[model samples]
Target: MVSTLSRRTLLGGAVALGATGLLAACGRGGSPTSAQPGSGAWTFTDDTGATVTLDARPTRIAGLNDAIASLWNYGVTPVASFGFTGLADDVNFRGKDLTRVTEVGTTYGEIDIEALVAQQPELIVTHAYPKDSSGTLDPQKPLYGFADLKQQQTVAGIAPIVTIAMSGSAADVVERTVEFAQSIGVSQEALEQPRRDYDAARERLRAATASGLSVMAVAAYPGEGVYIAKAPDDPALLSYTELGLNYPDPGGSDYYWQQVSWENILDHRTDVVLYSLRAMSGADMQQQPTFAQLPAAEAGQVFPWEFSAMDYVAQARTINNLAEHLEGSRKVT
Candidate 1:
């Protein structure tokens, strides 16, 4: 089980003042110390072509659970957030202090309206995907940690929603998100180093991929099957392709992944395997008889990958991790 940071520990100085004072200090009641609401009104256009306007620069902010970490890294910590189930056990949040933020809900489509309203957020941030003609997100899939349209309506009643597009290349998404953060008062200075780090990491990965090593990104569903990620459908995978990593198209009608049985996993052979960190463990994969047959698996070239990373720091870390994995790997397929 993953250990969680407690509220008292994270908000040491403010905890002594009690919940009300702590909430105020955390940018809940009035303007944040770092960013004061300017004389002019604040407005932003979301990816869905919807414009959100505010009377004052929103100091009390709320976000989807996954988005909170990214926002915090960009110097815009949220006062409240809704998370997916088992969020406390997520390794990505380990050692991170989120105790000052109130958790509004634990699963998608389920929100604690009372708790959210209590936080009195003036702005809400989340990710948006391209919508089809029928008014559904592309691929008609549910985004992790995001609520459905009906549930979103409820939240909208409380505050204007600002969304960053989760589609397109990872760099595009990261850039747009940073732009959004800046519009809301996060300083460019705070974002400089992370951007520089990402750029440097990208160059390093590009050099590593020049060796023509093919990488296959996949998620294993222990008892069900394997879902091979396709570059065109995944932002992160597309960014990898742009960085020079060779990922073969899984040619199919599906916009996202190509589902394959465990027995046929080797059909899409490659030199390196970028497996999902959220899925079955590396030990579990190695224990499978079919997994033992793959050259990449046998050579131990599998590296953990997270497709949902939305911030510069996380993306930079991901690039560095991939570069390290490919350091001594050779083409095996």
Candidate 2:
């Protein structure tokens, strides 16, 4: 188990993250597929618009990107997770310890093809829409075209493919997640509660903010710096905006999360700070050198949110969870 850092250290790291200018390189690799039958079928899609059909609903799934954190909420833990080993290492998403999960790649759009093939995942999940519609494939790594991911499966004779979006917006991720769970026969009842909870939470937050509570959603990582979510105005950042929260300048629209410094956070003096963390314990931030100095921390204004919600449907459930917790001003233990 990794130990949590002191609050000062955590806050200092968050400050550093702002100065260093870090943004998560996350995006789904494919477009939404036409729904079809596949129970326990190994399904997959490549980056090139080709589909690879498999025989079973993948049990040993392999997630190629860090944004797949939503998969866990749906109970779709992969045998291997690219990027960070587990949730603990993830600065944005917390409550997951992927130490048991395989590390497939570092950063979005990059994958360990050889290692992926070795895992022999029954199903391979990746992003497709970002590439198909946006033409925003990572410039650095050779992003796998839909066809490429499929071809890889053909060679290994593994399961088929499934493609979902990673970057459209929070809602896009949520809908895709519901669709995926529905595809696999996850109970509608199981899924519905989270949505309802999210709705209730949203309504509650909006009501609470009527009294005027300033809120900002932030993604803070140690060396990477703090990046605020785009404002809720655009289709993407709409969720948080509905809560009557204010985003630092450059509201939404930045595509990748926007970097913010402690000074910037203080300047805004937001009444609430929604932060993302992966497997962070209360003790972790307490030990950090600079965490307590931050206005949010000093004022007891920070709340921990997981970064795994980049996948939409799962995000909705997570949003609901966050709403339930924060609506009552409940702090994460």
Best lDDT among the predictions, by candidate number: 1
lDDT of candidate 1?
0.66
Deviation in Å, model 2, residue 35 alpha carbon:
9.1
Q: If candidate 1 were superposed on the true structure by all CA atoms, what would the RMSD be?
A: 10.0
Candidate 2 is scored at a TM of 0.58
Clash numbers, per candidate: 0, 74
* lDDT by residue for model 1 (258-329), tens: 677789887878888877665676668878788767889999888776644478887888788888888889
> Among all windows of ten consecutive residues in candidate 1, which has the lowest summed lDDT?
13-22
Model 1 TM-score (2 dp)? 0.83
How high is the CA lDDT of each candidate model?
0.66, 0.47
- Candidate 2 overall lDDT versus native: 0.47
Give the runs in model 2 whose Cα sits over 4 Å from its true position: 1-50, 55-59, 65-72, 75-77, 87-119, 128-161, 187-190, 219-227, 232-237, 248-266, 276-298, 310-333
Q: Ten residues in a row with the worst lDDT in model 2?
A: 14-23
Clashing pairs in 1: none
TM-score of each: 0.83, 0.58
